[model samples]
Target: MTTVIFIHGTGVRGREYEETFKTIEKKIYAERPDVKIERCLWGDKLGTSLLASGASIPRYDETLALDEEEEEDKEILRWKQLYCDPLYELRLLLLKPGEERSDNPFAESPLDELRSRVDNFTPSDKLQAKLAEAGITEVFGEAREAVIRSNAYNEAWDNVSAESLGEYSNVISRAIAAQAMLICYQQEKYAPVLTNAKLRDQLVELLSLDLAEAELGLGDWALEQIARLALPIGTNYVVGKRGAVTNKISPMPCDILLYQARGGKIRDFIRETIAEAEPPVVLLAHSLGGIACVDLLVEQSLPKVAHLVTVGSQVPFLYEINALCSLEFGQPLPEHFPEWLNIYDLRDFLSYKGSQIFPKVRDELVNSKQPFPRSHSAYWEQDKTWEYIMEILPR
Candidate 1:
């Protein structure tokens, strides 16, 4: 009998992915009735303390009082507070007067002329003026105040460029350029701007530049927030929770996975699971779970699992972050690493190809065209995902 062990990714309890694993189990059993399917249940182990500590589900009355929509909006605002606002504030730094000119092509054109016209071009003044022109001054004023009050906003301003906000002034120029393009999109008088393919391309190029710049300034915190937000939203959307904003869940488990991986707890758990499993084990791990598995296989000496399957994983990126246990700069894959297959979807922001990074492993790119959270979670439901796994299993 083959032992099929399933390990789930971050931001999830073991049971959350039960349906996906069960589906794969059913398919495997149809072909090989003797297969014994087991779940690592690592997430459950991590959450045990919380559950034991009286982290109960909200009472019925409390749940009833909870406006999911309001809560979701608050969560979204919290996400923007953590992720977008830092970039926004940094972008504002660009609007400050007497800053150096941006080399960005868009910054040289009509957009530069617009920035020159804003009185003083200070952050608060420029933002207020722009919001007034957009007819959202009141709403944006409140939002801006909220962001200014946030710890993330203050920390970013302090740590990123406390001396000269001038260093990031170009970001504001790009924002003005984007606003110009958006204005063109809205006004019939600027219809030609939209129809001109070259203009459209230039606009896209400018926007891309803006994002790249923002990413550089936003640093690691923004990346983590993006990853955390993507998974739950993707999974919830895939499972028909599209309109349910209250479904925005925490990525706390992701933190748990990282903590465990760094502390060697995950390695210990994997070792225990492998020691107890029957021979010819097929290890199937998703997302962060895949990263954890790879860490164990590389850093420790353990009995060989016949095959390793990683779905919608961020192993490559995780390694880049120095989160992988045995990863070394320019080091080759450890000799004992199992035969590996990585499956990822283009739409899943958290997922990326690992074969090039760990050259021995093979990779397959499957399109799960669903948006953020759905794209990340869609792999398990895809028949192609299982086909790849089945191919690696011992016959």
Candidate 2:
């Protein structure tokens, strides 16, 4: 099946993709009724995972000789694993009360309460040992030693401010909840346990027995409740950030996952709609979605995607960007790119800076420069960009 996956760029949410996807899908469907159509929404759950992963992308390279690099990598890896494989940490965090197994929501509250007790708390010798094993000595060491640690956990209860720890903590919590939902969706074996009441009852009882042996305070019931609480929190987060990024060019790692999941869903729909169809795909992508398609293309071959139309694309050589804060825009494109097209507004500062690397794929460059009234947001609002896409899409 020929599929045109519409990946939204940067801080734009999946709904924007839906509006754009439907518009394009209807045209393709009408043109060729026998063809299939699919839209992949990798944006939903995968957004947070991608953001967490990006957040975990170790702002510094571990191979660097600098001590700070090693420390930063350690923290990045820790945060990455916590999002990628959360159950293990959740297991460690579960707080046990003596005998009774309370509801899942409060199961880990006990451990959190204890962790809050220390005054500028130093890591326990045991935690330090674990950190050593993980090659993360100063993971939270500096953070623990901060003046903020001295404030009672409840101190934030009375204060309502934008920079409050309460706000950051809630963000972390929501990010985690999104991850838990992804885990549930990804693992098929866990699905039945979540869906069937009879199985859930049996599993909860089984987990309870394990808890008893470990002397952990949490029961199966509590863990289940936590998962339930996390899903909604994560969903609301994606819905909230529809199309907005203040200073940054792209959504963080977790947000990317959410975007990709949405993209994947749309891809599936396109595939179902157009069976045994092979038509050139024209992707009108902006910002991070442009980079994501490049990454996705590495694994998923698009035989029919004749033109990858990028607007305000930031597909730079990662090494180049790291070495120089500003990469001299290069027209040399990589061999890996499929048939390509690019549109950039000279007014947009980001477009001016991004590598014109698209031409490197085939040593071919098709530069379509249009004057946009607004700086960054003009990619969609301008009528000329759509005309350019319709002109460039392979017939």
Task: Give the local distance difference test score of model 1.
Answer: 0.55
**Model 1, runs deviating above 4 Å:** 48-248, 252-263
Compared with the true structure, model 2 gives a TM-score of: 0.35
Error of 1 at 49 (Å): 7.4
Candidate 1: clashing pairs of residues: 94-169, 233-373, 234-373, 234-374, 235-373
Model 2, 1-395: lDDT tens digits are: 33455656555556546654655565556554544445555555344424343443332222212112222232223333333343422332233222333325745543243334333344455544433432234323332333233233334223222222232233223223324323543442122222222332233233222222223332233233333332212333433442332123345443545544554543443333223345656555566666555544543555656667666655554324542111233423344447655566554444533333333332112222211212344354344555665555554
Cα distance off (Å), candidate 2, residue 325: 16
Per-candidate TM-scores read 0.49, 0.35
**Worst window of 10 by summed lDDT in candidate 1:** 61-70
Q: Name the runs in model 2 displaced over 4 angstroms.
A: 1-3, 22-38, 49-278, 298-301, 317-319, 322-336, 352-358, 361-375
lDDT (Cα, 0-100) at 198 in candidate 1: 34
Candidates in order: C-alpha RMSD to true structure? 17.4, 20.1
lDDT of each: 0.55, 0.40
